[model samples]
Target: MGKERDGAGQVRPTTSLSPSAEFPPLSAQDIETLRRLGEQWRVEKPARALPVDPELRPSRPGAARARGPDEAFRPDQPGELTATPAAERPDTSRGRFALRVRRVLLGPPLSSMSMLRERMRKLIALPVLSSDLLSSVAYGPEALLTILVLAGSAALGLSLPIAAALVVLMLAVGASYRQTVRAYPHGAGSYLVASDSIGPRAGLTAAVGLILDYVLTVSVSVAAGIAAITSALPALNPLSVPLSLAVIAALLAGNLRGIRVAGNIFAAPTYLFLVAIGGMTLFGLGQAVARGFTVIPPPPVPATEAISVLLIARAFASGATSMTGIEAVSNAIPALRPVEWRNARTLLTWMISILILLFVGLMLLTHLNGLVPRANETLLSQLAHRTFPHGPWYPIIQAATALVLLLAANTAYNDLPRLLYYMARDAYVPRRFLHMGDRLALTNGLVALSVAAAVILTAFRGRTQALIPLFAVGVFLAFTLSQVGMVNHWRRHRGSGWRRRAAINALGATLSAIVLVTAAITKFASGAWVVVVAVPTLVLLCLGIRRHYDRVRQAVSLHPTPTQLTSAERSEREMAQEFLPQRVHHLLVVPVARFDQAALRALAYVVSLGQPALAVHVSPEDQEADRLRDEWTAWGDHVRLETVVSPHREILEPLAQYIAQLRERQPDITLTVVIPEVVVNRPWQRFLHSQIERRLRRALRRLPGVVVTSMPIHLSEVHPQATR
Candidate 1:
């Protein structure tokens, strides 16, 4: 045995090979062949030397010497070249002004290594995740009352019973989701649960439902927040749509800054709203105690219609929108600190407890104070007035309510992007959604959610009532699917307490399905149909995207045996063989629209490549073709010229057909379409020139074994001497 130093200067033992063993010694011819192969490999892949900063280079005693640039240390071992450190490389892609604006809007970009630091602790996570569920109290009661009020004020008594039922539903869903977090610690939420336990279709259905719910959560939350603002000051009613959009944009900017920063920025308002509501509830109950629990008769108003079972069902369905954001914690378990499942479960429990208390407290106070839904003012606002009519607390509570409502969309902002990222990983959505931005955030998903929410808000004109009907259907659908999937999961993987877990999920599934059906049926005429149609359409879209990706994978995947190739695969294989390096051939074609300096430069570049080059011109008229040929002759005809006169005056189609013909005639050679494009400095100047190269490239890209490249000649570069 002998010792040899490894790449890192670690000594390792090496065993000597015995020539007498099975293998014979190398002959002179074998040694010469190995040497030639090594030389060829070296020629193909030369080692890249990195320049060491003179000040940073370490000095060795008795060997200290200044090194010239050419004498810099070169890596002798293969694949040992050091990459430039990220800290030393500055990205100059974005302009300074654009970067400044981005920094001002989104804060500084966070390194991916800082992901651990970005994870939320319980303090920040609770508010960040629970805002939507908590803030729903501001409008849940109003939606219920608004529906019941259509029948009469007498129907308003059903609010308490409906509220009680909603509390039970919230508990069941929250508990079921706790189990979900334990089961799926990595946090794909309903999509993962349904896909694994049920089927891919079920998972896609659940994902589409969650996606719609998230979009609606943003729109409805912002609209309700604006409603609160307008309720306080009716003068702002005309600007509701604009105000809602602005709030959404602000939320998008905040979240784009990354999770931790958003949590910090949004935490105060959630706590404030909780305190204001809790204090008001306690103070109102105290007043009720002083009055010996008297139920004040609400001021009489004319009944619009007779109260019936359907009216109560519609009210229940509408009020169920309160539970829209409940699944967020389960979906975002990965966003929590260590022991993510436990923290997520704990956070979920706290959210449900707070939500139940606030919701029930507000409902009881609304009854006790005899507050009804009004067009200009929210029920919570009316309750606030009754609780603290004479103090500054009314405005404070109103302000807190408004702020929390607007920011409540943060919950959707947090989970929707993650859910989309999971779907993208599964190839059900566009792959771009899987990418994290410079801030380590799912930027594409966030932007998509923002745009979708903005469109919905604008369509609904930022009216809370108008948007409420479309909200709960998607929410309860996702809940039902998730709970059902969990039930299946518990049954399949029966553990010690599996039966109990199965029972809990079964109860949640039953309740969620009832709510889902109720909402879909009662609110069908009132915009719920939009979500009904949208969900299936989105699901189909996702399936189509997946199918497309699968086909692409099948076509491009390398197979072990040729016998396994399908007919389509065989065709693809035949097309792929044309570009294989074993049969090297090249045909470089330059498409010349006109005989100008740009065309001359492109011809020169192609000729310099020393390949079989041809210059083709597509002219609408014979006179133009003749003129181009004459000009080519005068320019010394550096490359072969072939002009195709198109009497129909189609440029891209004729050129594409000509190239396809070339590829068909010589299927063995690879076609390289070198397009010469005019580069404009100013944005408006691009419109002045014909952008034929872009369209030509797009047309040529469809041909197999045809590579498209552009040689751009900037207007400034066209006349360098003139500029000087």
Candidate 2:
């Protein structure tokens, strides 16, 4: 062996033919072939220079490129990558391995536009869609009687009256929504109808109301469920907030698996709740009527307060929560299987009938048995104890109640994302909200709703009553707006029996408006001001969202596609080109992690492109600055090193400022930033690597003309490249 000098006078090892065999001496042909193989590898080391063919062996699958290192990060379909890759994160890395585990628990990813087969038939859609409305019987009478008994026993008689009025409001709202299903079959909500008929301002206001209702529904239902859970298992009382969050997470996961799957998972609990409550109603009524509705009233009211018209109206509005989720069936018509409208209307009727019977019966039983609400425990718990006594069935009743209430949040999971999808299609929200998740469900919207609800539940300390006064406002607001929209629909299309339809909607609008005003006034001091502020604020946000989308459309809108460009225009090269970027100024900006073989290889790769390049160094102090300066000089000084001084020892900001200065100086140039990165085979080795390149790439991308690219180096053997 001997040493030879490279172009830079660096000594390299030279190989010669030789033989060394353990068992026997090798032949001359074998020795010659081995010598040639070693010489070929020595002649093609990438640290010195790229080979003639310039092919790179990447360390990771899908990181290798057939083109150039500059084009490795370029997306295959450039202009059409609006959806994020995380929604469909491949099972390739540790992060994706965790995602793969989560997917196993949450079910597989659903494809978009494949939800046609995922729709629910009547058998499946009934409990899936009606759980919220039916579950309200768990609290509807309690919210009313809690307010009625304020007169120290004189007010107890008014419970029946308030209950009757609420039932009427439920029927009116349900009938109006039923008509909504018939008129607007392609998914009708207050936002869609009010926008199409009553104008966009009314429509967006309705949208805000629907959003608030859905969010509050999730918070209230989950908190109430947790309350029931803690009541049954008193040991869990201290962990109420955490338990509420966990239940929300469970509901979120189930819904993300697609509607049919989630519906089946939730069906058993809903029917159990129905049987438990329905059985209690019959038992309490049968025993009460046997004794001719005789009851022992509570002793002298501890607190003496008079009841008036406003008090009765407030009580009425609060109890109307039974009707809170009645609009869900109509809002989710598109989610029904084939007979979308017919199945929806049928489910709407079944839900209302069940709601009225169960809710009204529960109210009457509370009247017959003389149970009153207190601050510490829910009235449903009180009724369940009275109906079942300390028996074998009591725990089952409580379990069923808790399960149904928590699953009630599935209503919002189903409707809110679908509604958000509509708004996104019209550019009223972020465009990504329009994407159907891998499971053909709205995963992003589901996550957003869950986070917001979890925050609200935490802030309120998981108390149901605290969230109760904040309810009813959004429900009645949406109800009123949807009714007004339907009135417009009847007037515009006067097809058949339009008079009856218009009058029905007009009546619903009047009744719901009265409830809206009553609820807002009664609960204003009890935290309803938040809703009052939120409604208009959300309306303005939606308006701002629309305005921003319009501006972006104006900014990015091409006057004409290439097909519209004339031959003269194409020849001029101004009006039309294939990609519309008339010129591309390749500016390679490399931020060196350290002056090593990887760094030099990346620099050589960029220099091969023959573009104006910048190599930036952000040093922590003078000593390190001097050290890097010497290191760069020792690496053969092919490109001038640009030193950026950082008095504050910042890494990304100074480099970002330098890039901004470059942009201001070269206003018409496209700047491409090239970064050097290393890939380690073992996943644990990645944690030891510096993340400076990632931070710099993120910060530099905000500039208009800047493009970020990466050149990867492998620490292990050269990996065979693979395509995604």
Candidate 3:
């Protein structure tokens, strides 16, 4: 593959032709033409020179000329190709104070050339991408128990069976995504897959669902981490909301530093949590084996709800939250190093293995030790306390669990911005979301995710139980759509082993759909309705934004045929004619507020253009208009003057009406509205005067065949002899 620049100045990948492909032989005339063009290019190319200070250069006919403030308005002149030395350039750093602060918060900016260096190897990618799936082991079994315990102690025995079912779902979904990586190595995000295989509406629906899922992942993961902290230290219970928000802010700062820095910072906690949980599960199982693998009965409590099919279904739905982040690896394949799809598949397998071992091991240990969910403490904390009753292992386990859970929101942060970038590229969101910051990270999307998560965490008061009901619905909905789309993809482009791939995805889709419907129906009244309503509304909003962009593109696009030309095309053609001075027909209209040095300078520049010039003024009283006319006469009447007297004291309205009339009378001629502006040196001095030029430009932008320009007269230039 090779890279080439498109017309829009973006780099895109192109495939090289095979060596065996046939090509036409070059003729003698074609070879001669190519040789001549190469010689001409070498002769025309400018010579390379070292930068020199403008002040140090000698004053000669062909010497480099210094640029004035007004030079930006004029076209570039030939033989002006000297580079400016850094020392003599204007001090632009004063205006970049905000950029400096961002640098402090997010480190120094990385160049776009360093994008490949930012990719993660499999070792680093595993923990960075699997944190959410791995951290869910801390809460997944507990969520299941919480729902089941409502039917009393008898329902606690059913936890093992429910956990086994969740494991199967995780394996199937993981396998399906592995196939997704192979099929769509570039990116297999749900929106892209569903939009390609299914229709655009289905793709948009999946995009909206995944967006909700990512936002809730951040809020819920932080809340759960805080829950673990308060469980270990009861003194911190009252500070849960504040603590959650603080953790979110920290994640935002770390991620804004770019992908490599974030991955390294967050890599350690996930491994620690895995080791701690893995050790606890092993120790607990060994102790149970010594005790003949007995099942200890849990403490008896009254049943709040009767055991039934509905109750079991709800428990299964809640436990399926463990499968939330399984699809992240497929969506973020590009973040991996070379051989991205293969590395992603290997990482997915490892994640599924670890998640299953921890999830199932914790459930079995809970059943053997007869532990139940408690309001004041988490189940993982309880298991750790029982497994290591006397040593420091319990605290170590709790600390690791809390840290990993807090950083699990990193997974959502990584994938959400990339998804937004894809959507923005397709015009589904604001174009600003497509911009990468100095660090090559999607800064707008990251900030948007942080604000949304903060609002949700505050509203729920950082309670994990309250947020769990709203969690898994969107993720499961996304999973079903993505898998179903893959099935269609395989059927359309069948190759070797295509039938096997389609069957695997079909099974995954069926299982995911069952969970999706179960979660939405069981948790609807609790909080799932919010997601149910939000997904469709967001889909419509995306479609509406796309429609608006389409209309704007059509209105501004140029056509090759003169009869089909748009206003923009005509304006561009007329602008080109400006260089042909003999054929140019333009009228200059200068809007004067009062007769001052700024207005006089603007009038002088307009008169120098040698075009028919007119000066217009709007006065609230008749006396003001009479005084302005007298001043123009005293100034030698360089240009014609037209004054309008208004009783309502409207400035922009009268100026706009006059310009519109000019355009109406001479429809074929271009009207240039030049306004003189006073440029203040100090920022605070700006509030002292009216900004009429700024407002007038906005008011006149809607008029056809009329161009607006500003002629600024600096305060220092107006009073050159004044003291600082």
For residues 1-724, what per-residue lDDT tens digits would candidate 3 score against the true structure?
2122222223444211111111223445446644544443322235557576333444576866455642322224443432323222345566467666776899876766688888888888888889998998788888888889999999898888888888888878888888877777766378777877787788789888889988999998999999998998899999999999999999999999998999999999999998999999999999999999998889887799999988888899889897678888877888888887789889999999888888889889999999989889999998998899988999999999999999999999999987876666567888777677778777888999999999999999999889988887889888999999989998998989989989989988988898889889989999999999998999999989888876665444332234334534574345334334344468999999887777878898999877899999999999999998998888788789999998999888988998999889988778999999998998898889887778899999999888999999887677754322
Top lDDT model? 1
Off-target runs (Cα >4 Å) in candidate 2 are 1-96, 110-114, 229-236, 293-299, 388-393, 560-582, 585-595, 610-666, 678-691, 717-724
Count of backbone clashes for each model? 0, 3, 0
Tens digits of per-residue lDDT for model 1, 250-304: 9999999998999999999999999999999999999999999899988786888
Residue lDDT tens for model 2, 517-588: 988998999988888889999888987988887667534433433344553455323432322332445577
Candidate 3 or 2, higher TM-score? 3
CA lDDT of each prediction against the hidden true structure: 0.82, 0.77, 0.82
Off by over 4 Å in 3: 1-99, 560-585, 720-724
Superposed Cα deviation of residue 687, candidate 1 (Å): 2.7
Worst 10 residues of 2 by lDDT: 14-23
* Estimated TM-score for each candidate: 0.85, 0.78, 0.86
Show model 1 residue runs off by greater than 4 Å: 1-94, 560-564, 568-579, 593-597, 619-638, 647-650, 719-724
Task: Report RMSD (Å) for each prediction in the order shown.
Answer: 10.0, 16.6, 7.4
